[model samples]
Target: MRVLGVDPGLTRCGVGVVEGVAGRPLTMIGVGVVRTPADAELGHRLVAIERGIEEWLDEHRPEYVAVERVFSQHNVRTVMGTAQASAVAMLCAARRGIPVALHTPSEVKAAVTGSGRADKAQVGAMVTRLLRLAEPPRPADAADALALAICHIWRAPAQNRLQQAVAQHASALKGRTR
Candidate 1:
């Protein structure tokens, strides 16, 4: 499966694409940041992010999108902007009929670093090691995005299996009722 992971921000949104089979290592297909001028209006920044994400979807045609969920404190403005950016990403993916999974920052950190509270540098280091890259992914945002993708890929199978088991149990229950 190919997954696009997004770390949303008003000024610079980070994106990464990774491909992997169910039981194989993930391969990095691409990674980059979408930059909007710091001085640009919030509306413009959002538009830029939307357009950039659309372009990415068009180019990569990823099967799924994984975005970092917003969790902020004492900064309503920042939280709102992050939420808006994440919405744009979800919208873009939905437009293409691609399923989107939202992962918390803590989840991504834990997946990559084995610690929910791991620092950025530690996450970056682990991301590099996981991907077997000679160097860390550039721009902290990009690394975060990649981590989000990794987390989703690692978690998806378990989620799918659980859902399947639930469905099977429901079907058996219905049969007995009949």
Candidate 2:
């Protein structure tokens, strides 16, 4: 499966694309940041974000988009921007009919580093090691995006198994009724 993970920010949104299946290593298809001027108006920043994400979707055509869920924290301004960026990401995926999954930062950190409260450096280090890269993913956002993809890969099996069980049960019930 090809998954695009997004770490949304008004000024600098980070995106990473990885292709892999459960229990296997992931291949990095692409990784980059979408930058908008910090002084830009909120509407303008959002428009830029939408356009950037659309272009990325057109280019990569990922099967799924994984985004970080917004958490209410002390910084109201940061939270607002994060929420808006996430909205743009979801809208972009919805427009293209691509499925989206939202994961919490803690969930991503835990998946990558075995601890929900793992620090940014720890997560970055793990991302570097997992991808077998020489350097850590820069600027934190990119690292977070990679971590989000990892979280999805880890979580996907449980969901797929549940779906398969449901289908099997339905098939058995139909056979008995028929």
Candidate 3:
């Protein structure tokens, strides 16, 4: 499956496209950051992000979008910006009828590094190694976006099976009720 992973931020929103399935090496199709001037008005920044994300969606046409979930931080303002940027990513994917998956920072780290407490450097290093890249993606955020995509690709199979089991159980229960 091909997935577009988004690491949302006000100034630098990281975006990457990865393709492959579980138990196989993944391929990095594209990786980049969308920059919006900090001085730009809030609305303008969001617009810039929207345009950037839309262009990504158009180019890659991913089957799923994996976005980093906005988690609480000490700075309310920082968190607010992140939350907004995240919403923009989700909106763009939903508009295209693409399925969206939200992964927490810890979850992503754990999936990539075998430790939820892994630091950025550790996560970056693992991402580099997993993708078999000669170098890690720059600016940390870019590496993070790729990590999110990798995490989703690795976990999707289990998630799908759980959903299928739940659905089948529900259907069986309904038939019994009748």
Best by lDDT: 3
Model 1 / residue 60 / CA error / Å: 1.1
Q: Is candidate 1 or candidate 3 better by lDDT?
A: 3
- Model 2 per-residue lDDT tens digits across residues 59-163: 999999999999877468699899999999999998889999999888999888999999999999998888777899888898888888878888888878999
Model 3 gets an lDDT of 0.95
lDDT of each: 0.90, 0.90, 0.95
Superposed by TM-score, candidate 3 places the C-alpha of residue 72 at a distance from the truth, in angstroms, of 3.2
Off by more than 4 A, model 3: 73-75
Evaluation by TM-score, superior candidate among 2 and 3: 3
Worst 10 residues of 1 by lDDT: 69-78
**Model 1 spans > 4 angstroms off:** 72-75
lDDT of 3 by residue, 1-178 (tens): 9999999998999999999999999999999999999999999999999999999999999999999988786467699999999999999999999999999998999999999999999998998998889999998999999999999999999999999999999999999999
Clashes of each: 0, 0, 0
Better of 1 and 3 by TM-score: 3
* Candidate 1 residue pairs in clash (backbone atoms < 3 Å): none
Order of models, best TM-score first: 3, 1, 2
Model 1 lDDT per residue over 97-153, tens place:
899999988899988899999999999999898888889998999999989988888
